[model samples]
Target: MRMLTYISVLFLAVLTVGCGGVSLPKEDIFSCEGFEIYPDSIVRGNRIYRAVSPREISNAWTLPDSTTVAPEFISTLPMADALFAKAVISPSFLTPEEIWLSLGFLRPEESMQALRSLAWLPENDNEDFPYSTLSPYWAAAAWEVYCATGSRTWLREAYDALTRMLSRQWKLNRSALSEFYCGIPRGVTEQSTFYPASMDEMSRFQTFSASVNIMRAYSLRIASRMAGELKLYAEREWEMEADKLAGAVNDCLWLPDLQRYGQYLYGDYYPIVSSVTDNEANLLAALTGTATPEMSAAMVGELPLIASGVPSVYPYVVNQTPLRPVVQALYGLSAAKVRNPRAFIHSMASVWNLSLDANYPSLWPSLVMKGLFGIETTPSGLEFRPMVPEVFGGEKQLRGLRYRDAVLDISLNGTGDRIASFMVDSVSTDSHSLPAGMKGHHKVVITLSGNDLNAKPLRIFEPVTVPPTPEVKWPTANDMKIVGHDRLLHYDIYLDGVMTQSISTDNYHVRPGECGVVTVVPTLERGSSGYATPPHVCLPDDEVISIHASSITPRRPPLHFIKDPATATNYIELAARHNTRITCYVNVAVEGDYFITVGYSNGSERCGIRTLGVNGVDVATLLFPPRRLNDWVHVYPSTTSVIHLNEGVNKLWLTYVGGTILFNKLTLLKRS
Candidate 1:
């Protein structure tokens, strides 16, 4: 009987895996190849790159070349929304004495500390609880990731946190629970009382939108699944409670007239009332079943009208209404409506383009492709579950959907009967046999900016000395004195002794280091006259070194190196006691050897160039063992294999690796 049961289960698994005689081969939905990128696409890419810098894209787009490539626009969701969410809550809860704790803002260890503190709150007799501000949003996001992946560890952590949150919620405001006022938990300790400066005006009822009810719902959904897996009664209770809360929310917040849920409280005097146009409310309404399918469809259909500003004077405006576009694409494509599905897609594309225009970045493209294009993967190979629109125009070609260590590119036929190609890490190739005739969306997620083989190196500072002072040139011990105004004291100034230049001023505005530079010609020759020198070099103790200037007046205005170029090389020279960094606009040509040189000369010694590259890309170069040259250096890309160079302008950046070095010029070029 046991053997028969095992066989039955296995058969069921197979049946579920291959249902309706339709099988989907794995494919990537986020493809950048066919899109008509504008001529200034590079600038948009730069914006995305900078917005999510230092995090390195890791989800939905890892390729075999050891590179993590995230769609610049698509990767911003995780970067910005996540950041905004965290920023909103960090001030209140991530503090000591809070019963319900977090890892303290963005730091995981700090969160652990808060959690541990909450676990042992009995010992800390402090009166005010902190972290109530951000708890719900953080927990909701955490629960979201766990649900999306079904990861056990995340579920476990989330369960523990929920347990603590429930305990605190029950303790602080038991009446709130009964009144259906489950929002941000109140502070039990004094330390956590100060909410964000912006939220000073928010009423207590408005706090649930911070994280409460939504996270509880998501958490309950996951707990239910986990309980089934582990046969845990607590999980069952959570699931029931989640459903109860969902029903309560529907009853309290649903607005049938507006086809959306209200933000925070339901009544008109409740501070944050429902903006009939708010997208989040619509999404919550649909997810919580507050809005009927027909209503949901209406909300989706009205997206084009809202976004195009048909009812209002403005068009293509985005301020605090995320639901207008995301929900339109997410649920619009999924819902069954008389309107062409492609119209929803077009609407989504237009909104996404608007976001780009306004300089917003996120993993939006990936979400659209996954939700609308329906390209997902399962345990039994891969799945291509596309939501084919009647007006889809034709087939769509997509490349670079990636997993932990796999890359899958796919091409879909309009009729959904064709399989174009499959490559994992640009090496393993396979011919896919996709079983045809399917009509359901698959769940395949590709990580963004992940698995980039030619990954750029971290920006590091390298220091190079400009004036290599030898032991012989050093003054004897008896002659050494700490001079207050020594002529050789300027760290980043470039001037040869033979130049016969002397510069000084009163305590007025642009007096030397204050901002502007003062240049003057003295009566001395380039080699200098007698031993004392003639250019009026200031001694260390001299308050001011008076020099015969053609004229003496403050500079027209102070200049910032970042705003205007002071050097001829276009390289902004920065003074540093340790290392210096310079940034320019330049593209790497090949994937091989690259060098960054800093040149300097006091009309004598030359500062040699330093080479730095990873996989032949000039991500960064550091010159070690600082030598003084005070001359121009060429930072070039040298390689065994040729890398493509784009036509037009590029910025080149240089930094001192270690020990200060003066940079006179900076350049980006292909090695000869």
Candidate 2:
């Protein structure tokens, strides 16, 4: 009877495989000839080759060539986006409390840390929470990492942090509309200057931003997924909250006339006016499943705005090409996956070409794996539901993909829009799912046929590496002493003349018996075109040595002396009272006349006056003129003053005379 039962099960299994209902292990299922070669060509020798995009140049810092995967038939935009997302993992600019995914070419970690800081600051006892703008989509970025790496450890860590952040956000920012959340007050938002919403600068008070709420819902859904993996009961609450938020967004934020969601709703200020239509918000709605199928279709219909490429905003905000819209647009495209794959491919290619022309490294490659390849993480395992455009013919392969404990190498042979057959390893399979608990290397090859199929894969040439000019020179010990006025980009510090540490600071302290050589590099050269005025640097011939005043201890006062995370430097602020003063003790290595340049910001209408004194002797009354209100990340150069410093420790005093000013660092440069 037992033998009969085993035979019956065996028969069922064979029957299922024969009927194409179950996969059967087979030897040599298909040929690999059609797939494109991956790890797209990279220039070998480098002075820092200007790759087609900025991130491509920077990608060498993290992703070595051996680990990179280049899939053929993938256009440059999606390729660049994938590379940028991989490169964005860095230490948080704020407290290195946690790793963060950066927003863009600027400080990338700040993109998510800003939001985390805002949400967790009030709840945590830690006083040193770095001040950054609030971002609601941090979890979404984290989810990308989880999907790519398949690290349960990373997922758990991210899950805990996001849960705490969500709880705090609920407590502080949640709207009276139940699961809905309000936007940060404009004053606070302006201070951070990093919210993803499109409110006019004049928009007063807090309102419910559709983007933020959708982001919250998206994050909750991700958290719920993570919780379920850990078998945590809290997953129910997260799912419940996500459902409620989505419903609220549809019920309250949807705009009937536009057939899209409104940008924001005036919080409790009735008859609510929802005037603006944000391209990014609508895209997010589609990407996160907040939008209905009809809404998704309507949003996808706006692909015409990309005449040649995608714009940051539709209806064109003058001089605005924010990264959010581009990213969101790609997400929308991936989510919609409309029937006209050829049009989408053409539009994406156009955007890629445009990005190359502009030298902007947009993160478009994210669309390749997530959209075109249609790779998704299921509880069972990784699922591949590719949406290959018929235009991209021949064979395309994605190699060297790291997923948890496995390495996935995927190959697709396309003759047309549809995949005729697919093979997993040596096994013949028609299933879309790769069952869970897959270990080691796995390969999936899909074959398609149509009239438009090309015989060869599309090829993009590797960037040419231009050698540095003969005049280009590394800084010597003498050059290190000359402080350039441009923002200190980084420092290569050597101990006993051997490279030891690399830091982003103008100041360093040498311990006893340890000789140190510090080289400071600036963000731009003197002739760079961004600023109107050339930066003031000590002449190459100047007999100068700079002491980083920020490194010195300042005498306590009524004002706060805080480290500005944006620059990773200390600055003093909030000294509005009379008779307030900050004193820094500086050790002068040489006795000579020096120019004392204080980095500060005076944004108010009135000028800030301060008395500069050397060892209690008043030297000059320094005047800081009012400049336009700038982002807090900026530190402008103050007018330089000549002062004599005796060898050994010299006391420098900034006596408060009036007005408001943010004092960054003080640099003492010896005169020629």
Candidate 3:
């Protein structure tokens, strides 16, 4: 596969060299390889890409690689009329987040229409959740809007919207991605298909991506900068928060061995090992400086490549693999900064190939202009810092480039990442920055300053090394040793699929014979991790097990054990607002669906509900109907739907969601 990629890459280099010396046409928009790319065409979608003509949406189009709106997405909805009555006034394409990053290459004044065409601050009345603000993707597009136009009016409006969204702080859904913390839950993010139903429920719960935390840090930093600009007093506070969050990400997600940041941290409080790395995580880590300079070097030097370009996530799983053009551009831009020309070319090739696969022949030319050519639209004018590779050797000219009221004809003659000389309309600027705000047609010329004497012949861009999956031994019924990683912080014990205990130290002990089977996952120091490792079920044993609530320890504080004539056993009293957790192991002889009945007392006027968890996975929501105010009830009043359980030890846990309820006992009966 490496040889094939190398060969394909070599073929591309040959084609590039063959076409290098030829003069490009004088077009209003950039053109190459028989394709025309107007700055607007990239987002509006050309005939070359999958152009949708949805009646409700504007003329703009979604990226061929992005989420595709179904043909009948709005048309097939039952209440389309009522739901879309407002959007009809100005239908928009919300698919402009990543695409916004490319706006950095176009002048702000000229590109305002394109920028404005995007569904501004996309969301419901008070719901403005931004992916870039929540996850780092290198190209800061929303920031480009102000940089492009230098409009303080737009800045103030955006600033206000940002403040309003930040005020809410992602409380809409308790598990939604938070702007200032590692808040998004794995169950909320992943679908059932992300992990098979047979797998341990812990596979995807309470997991938080490093990108979210890093993005929060970036958001705070940007907020601080903007606040200072807008004369808001909280700049210092936001700066401190940004620094703290960045430091936390460094402390938590670093994987020394891989020299990359782990995609996420799994588990609550103390996390288990989530030894996975994705393309987006690494790119963001490097681009945002979340990864140390040394770590960034390691990433560029050692991160492996997949059959396609950089795999969206390392260890790309079948069918679950994700592809996004925004992701590729960021990765390529990072490599460009590091002077690895191969990475940029390969990314462009990857996007070209991706376009072929999606049947969208045209690709984003900004990948070449903004990233490789290093020509950026600036508040003053334009900044030129070309990072030309050997393949693009010889003179290159870009004409009819729009900047405010000016049309630019930029000519480049470079082979390395430095400008030997630069001039705009016969005027010299030592800063290599020329004013685009000046009116009328203009000419800009730049030549490579660096010799690049040691530039190697074009070959394979990046190495392809697939890291081995990390594993740990399962614990036994009796006491056993903890298999630890060098960065190990703690360990979690799961029986069958239920998580029973979290061990913080070496000495591990549990009941023998009657205990459920166990599996273990490591917790890294200062970080959390988890596994999709399926639990072992179906042991040749069977019996009725009743777990008394009094024997269990409350996962949270301030719980009472009340004694009453309501039942044979005392019950654990969960306060009205205290969210408590009780974890237990259920040993069954047969693998089949079973009914779970709980003996509890709920005398409050309002009904109560408890979330039931099996193997650390949220399985069902249990309802505890209210009883009379004084009547103590404990006759197994609450029963759950028949939950499938493997023969052997399985986990059964309940979380106090609302109302006051006394947990007396939990009994599991095999369904006949």
State which candidate has the highest TM-score.
3
Which 10 successive residues of model 1 have the least lDDT summed? 527-536
Give the lowest summed-lDDT range of ten residues in model 2.
527-536
lDDT of all predictions, in order shown?
A: 0.33, 0.49, 0.52
TM-score, structure 3 vs. true: 0.57
Residues 115-172, candidate 2, lDDT per residue (tens digit)? Answer: 3454455532211111112355567666554554456776777788888767645523
**Clashes within 3 Å, all models in order:** 90, 17, 12
Cα RMSD (Å) between model 1 and the true structure?
A: 29.5
Runs with alpha carbons beyond 4 Å of true place in candidate 3? 1-96, 104-139, 170-180, 183-205, 318-322, 357-363, 377-381, 453-672
Number of the top-ranking candidate, with lDDT as the measure = 3
Candidate 1: tens digits of C-alpha lDDT, residues 4-46: 4334334433543564422111221111211211211111221
